[model samples]
Target chain A: MRVIVRTVSELCITAGTLIVLFVAYVLFWTGVKADNEMHDQIDQLQRQWSASATVHPTTKASATAAAPAKPAAYHYGKPFAIMYIPRFGFTWNKPVLEGTGTDVLKKGLAHYARTAQLGQVGNFAVAGHRRTYGDPFLDFPKLRKGDAIVLTDGTTWFTYRIDKGPYKTVPTDVEVIDPVPRKSGYTRPGRYLTLTTCDPEWGHSHRLIVWAHLDSTQPVETGRPKALRR
Target chain B: MYGWIWRHLPGNAWVRALLSLVLVLAVVYVLFQYVFPWAEPLLPFNDVTVDNQ
Candidate 1:
């Protein structure tokens, strides 16, 4: 009987250790790995943007000439833009990768492939992690109605105003990303941005959304915009 | 099962300890690389929608 008790105790210890390790992997190790990958992605994007800038001088005429061309065709899992939320922090910026695939989200925020292109006349929807994998949108609930959600596609800075939400809804609400989202107060089609992250900090049962309208745009060579000045 | 593994390990106490550690690590690697990813889709993490329609 004593031997059996000892064996059972050992088994319990092993099981407990395994559970602890799994929890650490999910909550901590994943974030470290994701943070490293995000840094690499941002560095690569900066390099590409600088190379492009050198190719075309930073004149307004050149910027206008370069503007009409739609963002490069979507390449799945590629980082294409950098998103900055002034409400988050002055140094807070995340690379926006294409595709919402699990692998892509592990690296940084992902753009919904089916949504409109960046700065276009439709909703440019994006999603990011809320709790694990660096928790890029951990402070999502703090976004106010006028917070600036700035995005740059290497050539122009598109500053959007929080016109509607920080709305709470279930995971199944897709209408939030419509060209004219139903509850966003906009009637006609226009340039819009929608950001989504899992709600409740650690739970994925619901989603938190914020909708914004494009307020202004400027060429990258013109220096930091007023929204990012501070 | 524990007794069987112990008998077949064929090593001194320290060697057996190292081998057991390696076995545990291999299990962790497999679970993270294969099992968790396969199970991820069934989880509620990535189910957000753009519209109900």
Candidate 2:
């Protein structure tokens, strides 16, 4: 009996230690890894942009051009853009990767592949983790009406203005990412954006969504939009 | 349980202690690189997506 008790107790202690380690990984270790991964994604994007710039040598006219050139379809599991929300913080930004798969999100925010491309005339939907993987959207609830959610595709700075949410909804609300999301007050087809993250911080039983409208778009040479000036 | 492994491990007390430390580190590395990532998807906190079907 004594030996059995000792062995069981030792096993319990080991299990406890493992659980603690896992929690630390989830909360801190993952964040550290993800932060570096996101930075690398952004760095790769910047390098690509610079390389293309050297080849094409974008003129001042092209830099100021606001013509809506159709963006090509995004490749899966690739980093293509960077998103910045003034509401998140001045230095808070994340790389936007194509597809919302499990591995893609471990790097940063993942764009819903089925949704519209960035700043397009449709619902440009995106998703990010709320609590883990650096908590890209940890302060998602802090987003209010009129907040700015800006993004760049290495070409244009797309500024979107939040119209509604931090709206709490269940995971089944797939319509939230629709071209004209139901209850998002968007009755017509237009340039809209949707942001979704898990609710209650540490739980995934629910989702929190925010809807925003494309306010403006300008070439990257314009040197940051007014919304991002702050 | 640990006593058995300790007794079986070849080396003096100091060397045995170093080996135990290495063992712990190996376990941690495996857990972080493979085990945790495999198990992470099974956990609920990672379900940050919405599916339409």
Candidate 3:
């Protein structure tokens, strides 16, 4: 009888230890791995941007002459833009990668493939993790109605204003990314950006969304814009 | 169960300890690489969504 009790206690101890370790792996180790990978991706993007900058030193001149065209075709899982939220912080920046697949999200914010391209006439939607995997959007709730979401595709800086939301909705709310989102207060089609992340911080039960409108755009060679200056 | 495992592990104290350590590591590795990934979809991690209603 004593031996049976001892064995049961030992088994309980083992199970408890395993549970703790698993939690650590999910909440901590994944973040460490993701942070490392995101930094590496950011570095690779910067290198590519500099190389292209040298090749197209005349890009600014052409940009001023021509109407803003669609962004370059994005390869899946590739880092295409660097998103900066001034309201998040002065140093808050995240790489915007293509695709919302699980693998792509592990690296950084992902662009919803079905949505409009960045800085385009329609909605450009994006998704990121709220709790784990570096918790890129952990502070997403803090965004005010007029917050600035600045994005750069290594050539042009696009500034989007918080026109609506930090609205809460379920994950299946696909209409939120529509060309004219039904409840987003816009009646006509226009340039918009939407950011989505899991709500409640530690649970994936719902999604928190923030909608923004394209306020301005400028060539990168012209230096930082007034939105980023402050 | 503990007694059965202890009896089956043929070695001195150090050898038994090393073997137990390796077994624990193997279990952890399997859980992380295979079991976790397989079970992730069923967990409450990614199912949030609303249809076009």
Candidate 4:
């Protein structure tokens, strides 16, 4: 009788163990599915907006001669999401937060509190990771002066072309936020985009900077392809 | 029957304990797998995306 009782207990336990493992796997799969679905939807939206873009992405299109009129809605505090970066092939449909802390970086897009807004008439600044944890800016090193960095606030997509430097070892010098980075008293050019990322991944000893001037700011109705805006 | 086989197969106490833990996890997982869907509201950050634009 005693032996029979022990055997029954073991069988029951084994059955329970199998069930738990299955549940864990299911939960994990569910989360992955949700994330992927959201990402796909955002990409589809970008395609619809950028259908007219004529250039093969890897090569810069001959400098676009036409630039769109600055949108009147360009405001200082409104949020924007990063629809995609063709140069680096990063497509994030998620809402972009303005800061680069662990949580915001984990999502996508950091607002670059130091730079100017897309239509603000100054250098719009933002930063992100170059590597580690789905690093969107990993290939930023390859971008050239004319490559486009697209930003959107869902209603419009703003394109900015690469303008300059992969600045190195520039201490966090909050002064970089002072309209002009690294240099003092130099008059900077028109509306620009400044993107910064940590170099080498393992160490934050240096900063990698990429600058771009506004190419065009297109509203959702202005024929901007959806694939370029999420 | 399968129950008879389970009752007779003897394993060390540690082994049995490990197996018991595995069993418990499996049962709990199954319960959660079916039960969690009904409790989505209680989960953290279900609507992670917000249109701040």
State the lDDT of candidate 1 residue by residue for A88-145, as single tens digits.
Answer: 9999899999988888888899888889999888999999988777889989889998
Query: Least accurate stretch of 10 residues (summed lDDT) in model 4 chain A?
Result: A56-65
iRMS, candidate 4, in Å: value is 11.9
Q: Report how far off residue A80 is in candidate 1 (Å).
A: 0.7
Q: What is the DockQ of candidate 3?
A: 0.36
Candidates ranked by DockQ: 2, 3, 1, 4
How would you encode candidate 3's per-residue C-alpha lDDT over A123-144 as one tens digit per residue?
A: 9988888877788888988988
Give candidate 4 regions above 4 Å deviation. A1-79, A90-95, A182-186, A225-230, B1-53
RMSD of each: 2.8, 1.6, 2.7, 11.3
Instruction: Name the top TM-score candidate.
Output: 2
Ranking by lDDT: 2, 1, 3, 4
How does residue A43 of candidate 1 score in lDDT?
Answer: 95
**Residue A104, candidate 3: alpha-carbon lDDT:** 87
Candidate that would win on DockQ: 2
Q: A24-86 in candidate 2: lDDT tens per residue?
A: 988899899999999999999999988987886664345433345677789988998899998
Q: Give the TM-score comparing model 3 with the true structure, all chains together.
A: 0.88
lDDT of 2 at B6: 95
1 versus 4: better lDDT goes to: 1
Whole-model Cα lDDT of every candidate shown, in order: 0.82, 0.88, 0.82, 0.53
